[model samples]
Target: MNKLIGKKKITMENAFYLLKRIGFYKALKNIWNHNFEKSFLNKRFEQMISIEEKKGKEEKNEKLLIDLCECYLSLNNRFSSEILSICVPCLLKVGLKKDETDETQKEVEMTLLALSEIGYWEMKRGLYLNEIEAIIRYHHEHHNLSRLAYQSAWQFLIFRIYKDYSLEDVIVNELHFGREAARELKELRESVDWKRKEERGKEAKEVIVIWRWINAIDNYLTWCALWSEELVGFLGSIVQVFREVKDNHREVIYKCIYSLKNAAESRVIKVEELLKNEAVDVVLEEIHQPKLYDKMTYECLLFFLHISERLKEKEYFESDDKVRKTSKRVIFEKIEEEGYEDIISSFLETFDSLNIKLYPYLSLKISDYFVNV
Candidate 1:
């Protein structure tokens, strides 16, 4: 893409149009691979955002708007805080809105993905916390848009919180030393209050939204090493909910696994706690269920690595006692103890074969793990 740009004089509109043609994922790769001098992409992104703010809701051009937001996201990782700030008003409006058609719906999905990717970048200005938080509270589970919305919001919060907490401390705060943090988290949990409506009965939309938030919060929390009693208790609640999951409850189970992944990945929650609470066992049972989605199964395998890597990072389960080693043997020790080797092998094979698009970082990690395994 940069080759084309360098060889030809491409206008901002043309660049966006070409990005629209090449697709979102490729556009991201293109931006990552090449440097657009003189803020070429930045100007284009600002222009598209300007247009979206001025006309996006009034006249929703599905193709153009989707491509534009995706183009901005393609360069989002390096985008300035000022540029990233445009997301709430511009992209979130489209992302958070309920879709009017199947075509428009997919575009909306892409828009939320764009927002999420942008959120993955650190927000230095700290603007629009209320607006972005509103996305989670009001629009996160807007029909089928929950995963992307929740993910976007989660990334946003994670990046912002990183400013104040060390990664190690973030993990620590979420774990044993987080009594005050637990209270804050509890209030945050109460703010959503998803269960107030959930206990009424299993209305699918309400159930999905409730579970979606549960799933989203956990997924967001997974990356942090932080584990508090409140957080653990919250996760245990999801595990209980997972035990009763039915076929229509596929998303619920998927989110449940997503929530458990942090515990698995970080090891901050501890093996005894996982067993005592039955979190690990319940997730493993769900993973092996024939009815579980293939994508969920893939993530199950992916998170096994998550668990082992965290142990390696924190110097747990180390046989060498000296150097930090991320060895397969260390991972398998836990896997073997849990009777998970065969299922893990099968799921990793399944995860390897799939054409995954999101979580490129995890995809690369999976490939490296397989090569070394």
Candidate 2:
């Protein structure tokens, strides 16, 4: 009888040891919590969807949307992509309904809030590419949806897909969404009276979002280096906007310059194109600023370096020259006239100060113009 009791005790002890080794208790707790949260969110979402389907219940729908936005905000960021995947299609469908009533506007605004929240979270915690692709595909197929809906979808797309060059190409080339996005951005920019203080303040809420979209386009250009002529034509307007708002919006200006620097480095935008838009003047203004070794300084220096190298390449100039008076020579003269020697010195100094290793190779490439001169 004692042997039997001893054997039972040994078996129980072994079971306990195995449980501890594999974290059985913690794993079970996590599974239970996940199931509970999923069930709760599912129930709440289903209730909102049912209310959304009822007609003439505008008051209820408004409250329902408000509650829905609040619920999403209260949830954890880990669920952002999942929530967006479920919510975007439904919100888009409602946005497409042909009822241009006050109720619809409220719905649109609330939906924007919900989407922006999820987008922020998704962007913060690295986007889920597959989920985002699905959203983009659905959005592209329903491109002619309401204006607000279109903006919401594009906002998410820009935030998530900007860094993925292949996906960006699919959107820009095959899908043609890039053209649509550019048109919308142009309209949005035109809508604001940027010169009027009161009007600027009134539109300030949307300014950041608009700039973000622009930055995304600029990023895409950095990768592809070439876009349709219409899209390329829009670069001038972008530079013009930078000139107008640079003083008041330093962060926005930094992003604009950074994009220009990357675009120049990519060798896609020629010096002549930049000159036509007065981009050189913009870069010069930033270059002369007191702040040294900053992002703007680095970007401006690199911009000039790339431009100078392109100027040195005779083949590029010969192929591109068409009906213009020695396009390459004229462009080189124009840039030199802007005091590029000082810009080169600044670049060399800044790079040398930052890292001893990079200075030699960079100087070799950058000093070519001075050598030829």
Candidate 3:
């Protein structure tokens, strides 16, 4: 039966051995919702310990040791985690002190990796919450585990919290974390290493992460508008970058322009000129098939209408009769021809909320139209 676990061939004994080797021992510990104890996991611990002891401190023996250790750890048992949880830290101290070698680094990396994998598995499968908590606490406190470690620990906690917490609680907590992360992200963005331009045919993930980070920065600026000049400056800088792209940079350009249109304190004549220019029309034409993420086409039109509405409000309030009448007629005609019911509806809702009295002539005309309808 013991030999079956080591065999490459199929057999009931081999299957049990494979299972026990992986962390089946720990999984079984939870079958009855019982607390994991040392005695219950003694066999798995002994097996893991035996590999390290037999291999000793030899560099060449590292791979063999890792393999044997992984086979034992895969049992996914709390007993195995507890045993490894103690063993790994001790091995790190001994391995680092004896030889600051690649093999030693590998030892530390693999052990932490194993722990991370187990924690991920538990979090993914929705079992052993306490065990997952222990793994996170341990990993989080360790400051030297590489960037991957920080990323891994963050991903683990987020998964568990997302699954377990209420939307309100999660949102409040994210805001706290977001503030700190935003600061760090700002520093990274300004660093020379944080290149904003994508190389031709860069992997989708890299491109997407860049897009999201830029958007996050934009969001932070808009959300913190009254608090700082930084957000506005960041938006302006991004617009400049968008203007420099030689290749078809419409997707990113559209995103930047849309964000600016929503949040810019003053309407940018430069962006307006760009939109009305022949070049932008050519770019928009090329993007005939719209993407899920491509709302720039519609947003640009909406932004123009919004600015027109603001201009109309100002003109009418100042009793500038010609300006108010001209703006209203142009906007009304466009809306009617385009059948932009949604934008028209939003405009009406905002007008209602603000309790704005339109110019008497326009007000009487809209009232008659509604009466006829």
Off by over 4 Å in 3: 1-206, 221-226, 264-294, 311-373
lDDT of 2 by residue, 158-223 (tens): 554534455556556654655665576666667766676443443764465556556556645655
What lDDT does the true structure give each of the candidates?
Answer: 0.52, 0.53, 0.39
List, residue by residue over 151-269, the lDDT tens digit for candidate 3: 33333334333344432233224223334234433433343222454443323233333344455444433333233322234443444435443244565666555555554223322
Model 1: per-residue lDDT, tens digit, 295-337? 6866666555665454444446523533223344444454566
Best-to-worst order by lDDT is 2, 1, 3
Query: Per-prediction TM-score, please?
Result: 0.45, 0.60, 0.30
Backbone clash pairs for candidate 3 read 22-74, 22-75, 22-76, 23-74, 23-75, 23-76, 24-75, 26-77, 26-78
Indicate the TM-score of model 1.
Answer: 0.45
Structure candidate 1, residue pairs in collision: 171-225, 171-226, 174-226, 174-227, 174-228, 175-227
- Clashing pairs for model 2 are none
List the lowest-lDDT window of 10 residues for candidate 2: 24-33
Best by lDDT: 2
